[model samples]
Target chain A: MRLLSHNLLQCNVKNCKSNNFPLKIQVDKSNIINCEFRKEPLVKLIPKLDWNALAITVHNLAKNKEFPEKFSPALLDDQKFMQELHRILMETHIIEGALICEGCNKRYPIKNGIPNMILNDEEV
Target chain B: MATRPENICPPEIYYNQDEAVKYTNSTRIIEIQEQLTERCIELLNIPEGEDQLILDIGCGSGLSGAQLSEHNHHWVGIDISRDMLNVAVERESEGDLYEIDMGQGFNFRHGVFDSAISVSALQWLCVASKKSYNPVARLKKFFQSLYNSLRAGGKAVLQFYPDGAQQLEMITTAAMKCGFGGGVVVDYPNSAKAKKLYLVIQAGGDTREQNIV
Candidate 1:
């Protein structure tokens, strides 16, 4: 799934309450495939994004590439800013890797550019 | 009667809080919550014990707590929303309600509960925006607290939603890391939208496998 989707996902087990969300990503391997960037989508997503969280994720995936420190109206309208976001949010794919949750230490695998989030019998 | 919005009851029932509340408050939500609790009680395999202390997380309107209370058990219900708690308090007999943010953590002494249950609450841990809170980290703290709060062998029965099979795996993996021994129960009758499932975790249990690495 997109990091955008990962950022919003939470665990819904009845009472599995502790840090049960955005299950940490443990990317054992990854494949960043190219995808078209859309300015409108990025602009639309700004309101839904956890800016700091997304920035941290982008930085981590981009090998420490820094995202802008602040979010401003100008940045929202800037095509350059939108392009950067477009590249990070949509283009980056986990060809092979896993997303591990720091809270529960769960690993969500990314295979064929898709995350395999299936639990084992012990974890059922 | 005014017509409800078409988008109100989308495929997923949990995405819209208003719709969730409406559904949860409706007769169907109550029945579903009760059934889920019954399933939890069955899974808990609660052995005969007098005065067992139980903690009900996200005890919305006290549906689950009320059912537990009916069994003559000592119950404490907590929720972040006062409005929700108020509804719970009204349904309950009395004196067992607290306004608490589960994401932050429950306010009770360690080793206080014999068992705990949260119904449809874990999903609320995620912040709509990243700036809101690190819900995953918050949830980790919550589980640690639960581990510390429960007497050895105390079981916590919880229900939450996984975005899909992928989300479920991530949670099960996390639960294992927290030293919980159990499995995810995929029992959602409906699957068009997001599916709701249950996880029965035992505290102070042996750590089994290293799945997340």
Candidate 2:
């Protein structure tokens, strides 16, 4: 699954609705692909994002790479920052792993580039 | 399209292997699905000149996703049928597809999607595949999660082949309980063969905005 979708996903556990975000990523394989870069979408998306969660996801997904510890509005114009955002959001992928919710500890599995987000009856 | 009593089984089982392949290969199904998808997208009043994050619930074989791809929008689909999604993987679709039941609540972040659409889906939720399932409760769960995932002013156009007026009422009432506003837009109302029901729901958008494309 692309970090783009991962960044927008959270635990669906009933009571954990308040703050089940920044799902902790534990991966065995990571894939990086080349996709055409367009800056407009990312700029429009920044306002809707959870900056802290995004920073953490990038940190885990882009291991050796660097991302600002915090989100800066000025980075929207920085070509380099936008490129990084594009890479992590659109290119980097998790092929096999599990996303554990930081809030409720619910686990969602990832297989074949698709995240299996089906929650058990109890969680629902 | 003849009614299939096979609806009694869960989608994953009913759409398995041969059924999935037949659906992708059938010209008639593809034509109807394509038209339904196009009609739904037209009802979703998303302003142009920007890429949108669209959620395609019950996206089968990426047919609906293909329409979004043509518009140059990024879409993520969730489906309950794995066999149908296998056809989508074979096509190398541009968007991401996931396996999940819409009857259950969504695992998506709040207000992440700019718009949403469903084609020839949602009606299945009316029939209980399992003894534990309740149609009204399931519809409520789906609409509530859809409302939370969408941006305040975003629109979600669901084109469903409702079993009857009762099913349509149940679905709309569920959406209204979740603060969704707007009404159904029917296409080809005079022709039963081409009739389509589109639930054009807007999440907290200004009521004065009456522009319908």
Candidate 3:
């Protein structure tokens, strides 16, 4: 799943929907797959992304936390920063991992590049 | 022919491995899905410009999501079947896929989607899949959450195969309760085989989204 989508996803557990901001990543089982990148889509994507969620995911996913803590409209013009932003947003993939919710500690497994967000009966 | 039966197994089991392959690989389903997806998008009347995000409900094998990508729009597909999603993955679908049930509702932040579409999936929620399932309650939850997920004035165009008029009424009533405007739009009404029912819903906030049906 793209961290782009992960940046918007929240833990849908019964009461955890509000604060499930950045679902914690268990990166030991993760893998990165190379993908094609175009600068325009990434440029258009900046405003839609949750800066804090993406930054936190990078830190926990073992990617050395390359993101800046704050979001600036000017970052769109920064060629050097945009290239690194492209690397994290476009190139990396979470092939295998479990995303644990900060609010409910619920774990959603990611297998074969797809994140399984289905919840059981009691959990909902 | 794939109507929702009261005692039918859940989507995961019904669309399991071999069935998923059968559904995705069928030439007829692919043709039908393509036509239905395009029809739904045409009804969306998307304001053109940059790449917008669309949500595909029950996006089996990414056929519908591919249509969204053709317009350079991004999409996120949610389905209840893993095997179906596996095929979507193999297709190198531009959109991401998630295994989530529509009955319980989605997990998107407020005002995230530009618009939404569901093809041939809404009928599944009309029947009780489990003993604990309540049709009215499930429909309410789905509508309420879907109402919140869209940007104000965002539209969700859902194409469903209703068993009867009663089923359509139930779904529409629930949506109305959650503050949705717009109503059912029937395409090709004279031809039984080609007839399709679409619910064109707009999230109510400030502006009322008028239905073009």
Top-DockQ structure, candidate number: 3
Deviating ranges (above 4 Å) for candidate 3: A28-36, B1-7, B205-213
Kindly report which residue stretches of model 2 are placed more than 4 angstroms away from their true locations once superposed: B207-213
Ranking by TM-score: 3, 2, 1
Candidate 2 true-interface contact recovery: 0.74
lDDT string, candidate 3, A1-124, tens digits: 7777888788888877556888887754544556666778788777778887888777766566556788887887888888778777766667787778878888899987788888898987
Kindly list the per-residue Cα lDDT of model 2 for residues A2-101, writing each as its tens digit.
Answer: 7778778887777886557878888988788788887877677777677787887777766734788878778887898799788888888777888888
Indicate whether candidate 1 or candidate 2 has the larger lDDT: 2
Task: List model 1 lDDT by residue over A25-121, tens digit each.
Answer: 6665654446556465356556655566676676676665658756778887777777777766655544456666655666655543344433442
Cα RMSD (Å) per model? 20.0, 2.6, 2.8
> Which lDDT value does model 3 have at A95?
75
Ranking 1 against 3 by lDDT, winner: 3
- Poorly placed runs, candidate 1 (over 4 Å): A1-124, B1-25, B127-130, B188-196, B205-213
| Chain A TM-score for predicted structure 2 | 0.86
State the DockQ of every prediction. 0.01, 0.71, 0.78
- The best candidate by TM-score is 3
